[model samples]
Target chain A: MGELLRPEEWTALRLSLLVATTATAASLVPGIAVAYLLARGRFWGKALLDTLVHLPLILPPVVTGYLLLIWLGRRGPVGSFLADQFGIVLSFRWTGAALACAIMGFPLLVRAIRLSIEAVDGKLEEAAGTLGASRAWVFAAVTLPLILPGIIAGMILSFAKAMGEFGATITFVSNIPGETQTLPSAIYTFTQVPGGEAGAMRLTIVSVLVSMAALVASELLARGIARRLAA
Target chain B: MKEGLTVDLDHRQGSFRLQAAFDAPPGVTALFGRSGSGKTTLANIVAGLVRPDRGRVSVGGTLLIDTNSGVALPRHRRRIGYVFQEARLFPHLSVRQNLLFGRWFAPRAEAGAEFGSILDLLGLGQLLARRPAGLSGGEKQRVAIGRALLAKPRLLLMDEPLASLDEARKAEILPFLERLRDDTRVPIVYVSHSLPEVVRLADTVVVLDEGRVTAAGAAGEILSRLDLFALSGPREAGAVLAARVLRHDPAFGLTTLGTPAGEIHVPQTTVAVGSTLRVQVHARDVMVSLTRPDRVSALNILAGTVAEIGNTLAGESSLTVRLDCSGAPLLARLTRKSVAELGLSVGMPIFAVVKSVAFETSHRPPAVREG
Candidate 1:
């Protein structure tokens, strides 16, 4: 299998896994927090926050990538500060691919979690409060556990989306083999060159298999959680 | 009242207004009312789940909320345990874990209610390893109760905990509740609409009508008021008597009760001899006789003088007659036509014929004998 495809293809697959895992991990807490706010918070600008969270889903991926580039580019406000103060570079790198993927997949992550939070009975939280749980304690003990399946599903969706991310990632960080070139970018690169049909087809098969595995894992995790809750 | 709970609050939500003030004398004060009368709202105010627009609430002399002074404790800090109508158990938690959830949050100074004894009390010994979803309705309520009690709360508030259960399930949990009241020292505020629940459980009764407390006093005194039931519902108004079990006539499946008035024969009860049972004699079930009528199917009869004949209550065709049999107070709901035909006056002699089966359900140990 290692000899069948070039090491560059293997590098792309590994980079894709790293970018997707990093994106899912980095955004998980913030995703859950935003979802909780959307589901339960009644503060001012709630609608605006909700819309902001969902903007990446509604906007074109290229447009979102362009906006991220403008805001996080070397000469941009946040980018210059990070470059000068922390000496960390994101432009035209694998980390840039992860950032683009995270932003694009965030909306799906938040939506699933938000729906689960909304489905939770407020009465149980109230009951927990009466049992002497503080607000934070109640959320940690009751709300968090009850929304585990939703969080898992959201993470899987984000991971899968990050694994296959193309337009946003390519726009933000150009496809560089072994760097920013993820599974989709590798497949796209292979299809563009001559006699690259076999390579493209091989990468496409791996992508499909990866997505199927993710879907199976999500189903199994959700069912296990549901069974535990029911038991 | 003793070292119990006191609440005086006024709150208005849209068109509804709640003006309630009552001293709950410790052992299971039942907040009695119809669905819309704000019984749950009042209970919520006490538990600090709902902030009263203006009022003071204190338990065991500790002021939980005093809107006038701007002294308010959050529900969690108030050390209150509320058992909701629904069990509200954590679906993800095992029965043992759910019971221990409150134990985790209990104050450091608070002594934990021993888990073993509480599990034993609620009959949850076999259920510790099981999850809440696997429990029956009655078993869930029992676990809910254990969860609340394990908090070692200063005050326990039950908001119609049995309301969501069927009659059989309600019956199953009621004995555990009675045992909870009898064995536990936690002061309880029990909110319920069912008359039998109040009669069987409450020491103090607070009657609510349209968001206002209409009457508040000892359970026996408040519950016996014919006028009080006219507003809540007249179908349940009656005399609440404390009668001791003299002996059981097992051959006929009957038990004889020795009341302050006379010997009363009731249908079989499982209570042992000498236990003081609360007997709720429904006013409608008591037939009045001017003379000693013989061969009546009703097995219990007590001769007494008419204490007071209430005027015809509004929207009801019947007048309530109060019978004073020695020191015991019995109520009889007679129509105006019967009042006139029997020539029943405040001082007239009468025979109160009580249907024996009425006592079948009336023989539970209510908290307060005087109430």
Candidate 2:
């Protein structure tokens, strides 16, 4: 496998792994919180919150990427605030690509988790309440364990989405070799140049392998959780 | 009213209205009613799962809810344990973990029973390592009960915990419940629609109809009320008597129970002598005769005056007759033809004959205590 790939292909493979892991990990807590809120909370503007969380899935990937660039660019309000306060910059960086992937993957993660949360029995929470468990404890002791499979499924889906992300990463962070360049961006770069087909094929094979591995891992993780819960 | 659970509440949702006021004594107080009678709703209100628009709820002496003062204790802070109809055990946790789930929240000082003893009492020793999904219906309910009991709740509310089980399953859990009732001092508010369950388990029965509490009193008094049958179905019409186990006749496989009405004999029971038990004789099983019949196969006979007579209830052809048997109330159900043939009416002298096999001896120890 090592003898078949050039250094640049290897770099893109490593960068894609890093970006997908970071995106999946970074969106986990917020994804779960938003999913729970959407599934159980009855506050005002619930529908609006739901719509916003799901917007990335409905909108075209380029549109989502462009929107992120406009809001998170160095001169944008949020970008300017972060750069001035923390001396941090995201534009044209690997972190910016990861950010773009995370944003694009958020909807799938939240949807999977939200559906599972909704499927949970509310009576168990009530029973826990009567048994002296506070709402937080009830969620931790009962709700969390019951929804573990969903959370794992969501994370894997988001990771795969992040791995395959092209339009969003290119539009938000632009293709830059060894910096903002990811697997998809590098593959696209290879396709545009003369005599780059071999490199693109090698990188594409790596992408397919990584995605399959993720899918297998997800299947095992979900089955393990179900077995533990059923035990 | 001095102690126990007192709930007087009014709640309205859409078109349904629940306005119930009842003072339930400790021990086991059953919320008895047919389906949609609001008994479960009342139990939920007491458990703090449902907040009433107007009312106050107090268990023992603790003020759980007072809408008048805008004071309401949250469900967890109220220290109330609720065993739902479906058990609702944590499927992801082992039975032991489920049992210990509530102990994490209750203060150490409030943890009353030893965990081992609770497991023993509920017969859950062999199931400690198992999960909820693997448990039978009866086992799940027992685990649910153990989970609640381990919580050290100030009050235990059971909302027809056995309603989902078949008869065999229900019978399997009843003995454990009886042990819990007799051994623990925790006040239990049992919600059930089955009359036999109410009679066997509840020391005090609160009858609900529609959304109103139609009757509330000692189980014996309420079960013997002839008029209440109009709401509690005529077939369920019966009398509960506090009886003392006299002795067991091993040779005949029978046990003798002494009640205020008279000495009654039943099939052999394991209950020790001198232990008090509640005996339920269904009204339909009681035969009424104008004159004392000689050479009758029935073993028990009580002479009493017909205190009241009601017309056929719930379209049943049988007329319910309330009798005062030496200060004890007894209900007798007779067909309209038999009532007319005997020319029976209020204040008429009647002999209520009961077969020994017809009575159900509720083995629950009469450990009546205030909540």
What's the CA error at residue B102 for candidate 1, in Å?
Answer: 0.4
| lDDT tens per residue, model 1, A1-231 | 447667898899999999999999999999999999888889999999989988988898989888878888888899889999999888789999999999999999999999999999999999999999999999999999999999999999999999988888988888898889999999998889999999999899889989999999999999999999887
- Interface RMSD for candidates 1 onward, in order: 0.7, 0.9
Identify the runs in model 1 with alpha carbons over 4 angstroms from their true place: B292-299, B313-317, B364-371
**A143-167, model 2: which lDDT tens digit per residue?**
9988998999999999999999998
List pairs with backbone clashes in candidate 1: B220-B371
**lDDT of candidate 1 over B1-371, digit per residue (tens):** 33899888899988999988878877888888889899988888888889989999999989999998999999888878888898999999999999999998887787867999999898888888999988888888889989999988888899999999887777777877888888898988888988888888888888899998888888878877767766546677788887888999989989898988799988878888997768888888889998878988888889999998887846767888889888688898888888888788888888999988776454443322110
DockQ of 2: 0.82
Chain B of model 1: TM-score?
A: 0.93
RMSD to native for every prediction? 3.5, 3.3
lDDT of the structure predicted as candidate 2: 0.88
Model 2 spans > 4 angstroms off: B313-317, B364-371
